[model samples]
Target: MKREHIETMISQEVERIISGTDLELVDVEYVREKNWYLRVFIDKEGGVDLEDCQAVSEKLSKVLDEKDPIQENYLLEVSSPGLDRILKKDKDFVRYAGRTVDIHFFQPYNGKKDLVADLVGKGEDGKLTVRVDGNEEILDMKTISQVRLHIDF
Candidate 1:
């Protein structure tokens, strides 16, 4: 009924439809511009192609149509998270260990607004140790307001 609940439902349905496939749902959003848009971002080990998007879109459309969770007119879109995917959960940090990431803390740490570094490891306490500019810093997980993979240009 609520936006988050709807998103979670859609995410679960998408995950189920793509279970055997390489794709995984990254995020889901229900937004309004002219009409409501239910956007679903998906990713894979390599990447997602248009064909993959089409397949997921078709299947999800059927389920949504049957469930009728959204009362208003909406467009469903399935696509990739692109080069820099945000890391929202602890699993993301563990899965992307050793990759370069940019994390923003809720409060400044050592007078820094952002930290760009290699994800060294996660401590037993759930804090993250990142190597930034050859120095290691322990970032408390509770303080991590946002995190994303750093795409090299």
Candidate 2:
């Protein structure tokens, strides 16, 4: 099977396994470094603890072993997406509203390719409205290439 397909399958299985639990499936990746790694990113309201990771790892491991989804040697790891997680889904956009975000645009907007501001949430048209310099800047979603939580020290 294709790598992406494998990842999707693994993600579906993990989602099912963690359903009703506090854990939420963030992202999944099956990549090769020195060895193939099947990394699953998970999260929760307060944050995921080691026990949560262990529970997910153990259950997902059992399912993967039984299903034999990937026909190769790989290491399965379950963990959090970390502090600066990228806002990939609609839920993320909603969840992180009112927080600072760094938006990378495909083309320069008002002579700038990137903007850092407070997320004002998504509009009905899917445009992202952010608070920039005390003003609301509505951005077309298509023009945006990436959006991540901006971490400041």
Candidate 3:
């Protein structure tokens, strides 16, 4: 099966699993490094804990083992997306609007490679709008490398 298809299946299964619970599926990743890995990122209102990860892992592992979705021998990992989670979906862009984020570009934009800005939201024209230094900046999605939530310590 294709990667996107597999991800969609996983998302659906996870939604069924977490239904009626506070846990939210942040993202599902199927990738290969030295070995194939299926990582499920989950989060809750107050953040996820080790117990939450373990429970989801056990249930999903059982289902994956029974269904045997992927042909390859892979390790399954379930965890929180973390504080610096990347904004991957449109819902994320909307959900995180007005929050501080770190925007990185493939090349310098306005003489800077990256800058901290308040996420205004993703534009319908395949661009992202962010507020920097009190002014709104519309960034071409083609030039953006990454946009993740930025937390100050």
Candidate 4:
């Protein structure tokens, strides 16, 4: 199976596995960095703990093993997305609305391609409504490179 298809299949299986639970599947990625790796990122109301990771990891590992989808040996890792979680899905944008985020753009907008701003949810036109310097700014979603939750310490 192709990488994208494999990832999609894994995501579907994970959604089923974590259905009816507080655990929300954040993202699933299969990458090669020295070795093949299948990472499952999950989150919940109070954040995920090691126990949560273990449970998901064990369940997913068993299912994948039984299904025998991948031809290569890969490490299966299940964990939280962490404080600086990247927003990839719509639920993330909605869930993290009003939170501060670090945005990186593919091209500079207003002479800036990187900055911290408050996420105001995605607009209907696929643009992002953000509050920067107490003013609202609409960013073209296509120009965005990455949006991650900003951590203030």
Candidate 5:
């Protein structure tokens, strides 16, 4: 089956499995590096522990075994997105607003290709507004190569 279809099917199953739980489904990715991998990213307000990952993995494994969604053998991984997780959706932007983030760009913007700033919010034109050096700047989301949470150690 196509990877997208596989992801969709698994996503639906995950949603069903996590229905009554505090776990929130973040993303489902089916990819092949040296071997195929079915990775499920889950999250909640505080965080998820190893028990959470193991439980989801076991339950999803059972469903996948019964359905046989993917043709090839793959490793199934269930885990949290972590402290510096990438922000991929509009909801992510909204959720993480007021947090510090590292924004990457394909080319230079304001003479720099990357920036570390506070995420203000999503702008009217679908751009991301951020505060840099106390100045608010609106950036086109298209130019953003990546946006990840930034924490100072």
Candidate 6:
């Protein structure tokens, strides 16, 4: 099967297993280094524990075994998204509004490649308004190369 098809299958199976666990699926990637590695990141209101990871792992393993989507030898890793979780979808922007975020643009925006700002809100046109250094800037979602929650230490 194609890699994307396999990934979609794995994502669906993982979502089903963790539906009632209060955990949100952050992202899933199938990496092939020495062998296939399927990494699943999940998060919750507070956080996720090792036990949660283990439970999801076991359940997903059973599903994968039954489905056999991956023909090659592989290892499955289920874990928390951690402090710097990447924001991918529009829902992520809405869900994480009012939080500090670090965004990297494909091309420099206002002569900068990276920005650390407070997410204000999403505009009617679907642009993101963020306050960076006290200046509010409207960023086009299409230009965002990567966006992650910022952790203050």
Candidate 2 residue lDDT tens string, 1-153: 899999899989998999998889999989999999999999999999999999999999899889897888999999999898878788999999999999999999999999999999987798999999999988999999999899999
lDDT of each: 0.88, 0.93, 0.91, 0.93, 0.92, 0.87
Q: For residues 43-135, what per-residue lDDT tens digits would candidate 4 score against the true structure? A: 999999999999989988889889999999999989999999999888789999999999999999779989899999997788998999999
When summed lDDT is taken over every stretch of 10 residues in candidate 1, the lowest stretch is 86-95
Candidate 2, clashing residue pairs?
A: none
Pick out the ten consecutive residues of candidate 3 with the lowest summed lDDT.
68-77
TM-score of each: 0.86, 0.87, 0.87, 0.93, 0.89, 0.88
TM for candidate 2 is 0.87
lDDT string, candidate 6, 2-81, tens digits: 88888787888888888876887888989999988999998888899999899988989888888777888888999988
Q: Clashing residue pairs, candidate 6?
A: none
Candidate 1 per-residue lDDT over residues 34-142, each given as its tens digit: 9899999988888899999999999999998898988888889899887898887667778899999988888998898788899987877978889988988888888
Put down candidate 3 lDDT per residue, 1-153, tens digits, no spaces.
888888899999999999999999999999999998899999988899999999999999888889988988888899999999988888889999999999889999889998899999997898899898899988898998989999999
How much does candidate 1 score in TM-score?
A: 0.86
The alpha-carbon lDDT assigned to residue 3 of candidate 1 equals: 84
Model 4 spans > 4 angstroms off: none
Superposed on all Cα atoms, the candidates' RMSDs to the truth, in angstroms, are 2.0, 1.9, 1.9, 1.3, 1.8, 1.9
- Candidate 1, residue 59: the lDDT equals 98
Measured with C-alpha atoms, the lDDT of residue 70 in candidate 1 is: 88
Judge candidate 1 at residue 58 and give its lDDT.
Answer: 97
The TM-score of predicted model 3 comes to 0.87
Error of 5 at 82 (Å): 0.6
